[model samples]
Target: MTPDLHWTVTVDPLTLAIGFAHVQVEHTLGHHFSLYLGPSVKCFDGILEGANGPYVGVGVEAGVRGFFWGTAPAGGWVMVRGVLASLSTNVPNTATNLGGYTSALVGFTGIVGPGLVLSGGLGVSYFDYGVLEYGVHGLAPAAHTNVGWAF
Candidate 1:
């Protein structure tokens, strides 16, 4: 990380492909620690269940990261992240679903150019749809890559 760098704004393309516009912002707290949070807007359009009709919702992610090598927001890092989402559909009299996941991830962030930041990571995520109606709760493989500008 640049000595004077304080913030970064990043986007996940994979999340966009799946119908969520996800963007994250990271801020350095010290030489080895940082905090990141983001929001996601989704339009599933009943991709998972036909009866649900159009599925729309919002999601959020908050996490703390620790850098073991290099400086904050650069080189190797580990993070514990928690995500939450609330979704509802066009179906009448249906309850909105609130779900999210928590993950532990390891990755590296590098500056490709002057201010271009690139990052990738893999980890296991514990996701609980937060509704027994969906019976969706488990540990799943997680992967992510982000491209952004560091300043």
Candidate 2:
């Protein structure tokens, strides 16, 4: 077990692999719960390219997590997260895409070594936005994972 950590910041590797930069930061709210905020931005053009131009988006992810037992920063947990975003093209005349994403998941957080942290969860993901018209959104069983250092 690692020492008590008040804040944890994690980056989603899968998102980075696909050109999106995503990160989440969580702070302990006593022994049973914590709150997190994640800001995501599209930094690459290959993923959402349009004939007119490339597309970009800025979004926020926020959620609350419940620790099943024991202290936070480690052990089993449950989370409910919501994401709201707007996507638009570099071209001036295109319409902007907007929508919300929400998920409920169960997962585990562990201190693999010292203050290093690894977390993974499985859940369903939903999205209803103009972006989906471009076939960019998927309604399927999804899983999420992240790696970071806790301090």
Candidate 3:
């Protein structure tokens, strides 16, 4: 077994309207085919105009990543990752509520320079806000890109 560590800074272009970003620490387990876990912080500044705009929120994100091409901790690989998060927000004059989202993605990870890596993927997202009765009714296109430093 080989263990690898990385710090990642992520952005989802599609979520730009809502101002979403993620910061995560990843730990990889196993050798040939790695299984990884990421603990993350998700931050958002607003929502779609129709839903509500200019409200800030923060969430905790958890993710699992599987690399099929080869070992992790080093090298290039093809990966699939699943992410889940829960967030709470308050809008001025509006009710405070909590929401959650999940994503399933297919991507690639490549080592660029010493201790540096880049990863990106396309996926679908499902989001729900129980209190507001508002959500992404079905699967919506999602994309993610991240730059990381591994040690």
Candidate 4:
């Protein structure tokens, strides 16, 4: 069977203009489950209210999928996958009052592929805003979606 490769772009709800790229890899793990790993780059829209500045973050996600439709060659599958990610960003020295922060996010992704797949899902993120802080703390629920090619 041929392998599946795809690129996913997700736009954040809070910062609609800001988006991230995920390089996705899919592998079959038997009859019911498939494994996927995505290394991503997330860009923020310059800290909230000018408290800090925009920063780039690096992270990775690992998840498994349970397929519910069609098979390998026919080209359509509906699968649910769970992902966990750790992201880090640097705070500018000019913003000494602000410190670097890391975030942990967990989310469920549903993918349907038939040449091009429509992807959408919801997630909750918990940020440990080290030095620079604003708004709420701990966990926040967010949603995302994207349209991209699937192969």
Clashes of each: 0, 0, 0, 3
Q: Which candidate is the best by lDDT?
A: 1
- Which 10-residue window in model 1 sums to the lowest lDDT? 44-53
Candidate lDDT scores, in order, read: 0.76, 0.73, 0.54, 0.43
Return the TM-score for each candidate structure. Answer: 0.85, 0.82, 0.66, 0.49
If the candidates were sorted by their TM-score against the true structure, best first, what order would they fall in? 1, 2, 3, 4
Better of 1 and 2 by TM-score: 1
- Output the better candidate (3/4) by TM-score: 3
The total of clashing pairs for model 2 equals: 0
TM-score of 1: 0.85
Cα lDDT tens digits, model 3, 57-135, are: 4556666666656456444444444444453445445565566667777777666555666777777777553334333
TM-score of 4: 0.49
Candidate 2 lDDT (Cα, whole model)? Answer: 0.73
Give Cα distance to truth, residue 71, candidate 2, Å.
1.7
Best by TM-score: 1
For model 4, the stretches where C-alpha displacement exceeds 4 angstroms are 1-16, 44-52, 68-114, 129-131, 134-137
Model 3 steric clash pairs? none
